[model samples]
Target: MPELPEVEVIRRGLAPGLLGRRILRLVIGEKRLRRESSPEKFQEWLPGRVILDLERRGKYLLFRLEGGVTLLLHLGMTGRLLLGPGPSPPRPHVHLVLELEGGLDLAFQDVRRFGQALVFPPGAEPDPLAQVGREPFSREVTPEWLAQEARARSRTIKNFLMDGRVLAGIGNIYASEILFAARLHPGMPAGRLSPADWGRVLKETRRILNAAIAKGGTTVSDYLNSRGETGLFQLELSVYGREGEPCRRCGRAVARISQGGRSTFFCPRCQKKK
Candidate 1:
């Protein structure tokens, strides 16, 4: 799945070309995505509307169009949004294509068909936004806030960090990295964390997320920028995907464990359980 940083990278990459362009037409594919609005709905709300702005909420991309209509996209595991000149050759797994006024085409391709494309009319709030919590970079997010939210919660710290309802845009990859940086064990119960512990987690979360965004996100598999470029952050990974490799800090073998069915990588010596 494309997490916060990956989605943010896409938003920044596409914003320059997408803003102010009018949607000339909608080319719908025969195959349907996991969550998509009807072709009639898309055609009715999208064509002839100019793209006013591009925004990202959690892992969802929001294309604000003229007359207050919003185009929402969620790039599931293997989804890619590629932009190129029109009259381009047909590619496989392209489910939606928006023909722009400048002869440019914005195509959404997902081999697994798990992505989402939805259109929301004026005054209608996107349903997916309701599920997204505060962004990690928000000033409102503080150690005190995290402590309050995790109060009485028995879930593991890793699971707490991965919960989109509490902190938006965090997934398995960043969760492991953030916990590793904070020197906190993934299996530690959420309620057991002190305010100082939460402070370290919050600081490292912002640091790692900003670094990932700067590096254009981690491309472990199918992630690509609008220009079809792979991310460089994977080369800087510390623990994730480095199972049994020596830890960069402690020189101890990096460990991998399963939490909530997702692999979590950390240093056992550094992130000792309390």
Candidate 2:
């Protein structure tokens, strides 16, 4: 699934092509996405509405449209939103297509069919964004604030970081990298972290996420920018998929462990349990 940086990259890529362009029509696929608005609703609310701006909240993409309606999209695992010239050849699993006024078409393709495309009415609060927690770059996300929130929480630090309700947009991939950079074991209890540990985590989280966004996000699989380009950040990965490879910092074999059923990679010598 596309996380924060991946989704943000898509938003930035699509903004130039989509902003100020009216939706001429909408093409809904025969098969439904896991979460999608009805074709009737889409057709009713979409056409003639111009896209004013694009924003990303957590992992969801928000198309701020004219007249105040918002089009929300969630790229579940294997989902891609591709933009192309008019009437391009059909590809497999293209769930939704937004026909723009400038002969450009924005297509949403998903191999796994687990994505979401929904239209919310004016001033309507979508449920997907309601559950997302604080943005990682927000000013309110200080180390002391995180420690206060984690107080009495017994989940592993890795699991805590992966929780979208606690820290939005971080999935298994970035969680592993952030923990390794902070030199904290994945299995350490969340509540056991000190202010200093959280300070490192916060600093590293911002640095890693900013770096990933700059590189267009990590493309382990099924992630592509709006231009259908693969992200380059995977080449810079230190621990996520380097199991048994020597750690870049300590020269020790990188390690892997399962947390919440997701694989987490780290350098055992660099990341120690407290």
In candidate 1, what are the lDDT values of residues 160-263, reduced to their tens digit? 99999999999998999999999999999999999899999999999999998898888986888887777555638889999999999999999999998999
Q: Report clash pairs, candidate 1.
A: none
Worst window of 10 by summed lDDT in candidate 2: 229-238
What does candidate 2's lDDT look like per residue over 154-207, in tens digits? 798999999899889999889999999999999999899998999999999999
Model 1 vs. true fold: TM: 0.98
Q: Which ten residues in a row have the lowest lDDT in candidate 1?
A: 226-235
Please, what is the TM-score per model? 0.98, 0.98
* Model 2, position 164: C-alpha lDDT score: 92
lDDT of each: 0.93, 0.90
- Cα deviation of 117 in candidate 2 (Å)? 0.6
Residue runs of model 1 more than 4 Å from their true location after superposition: 231-235
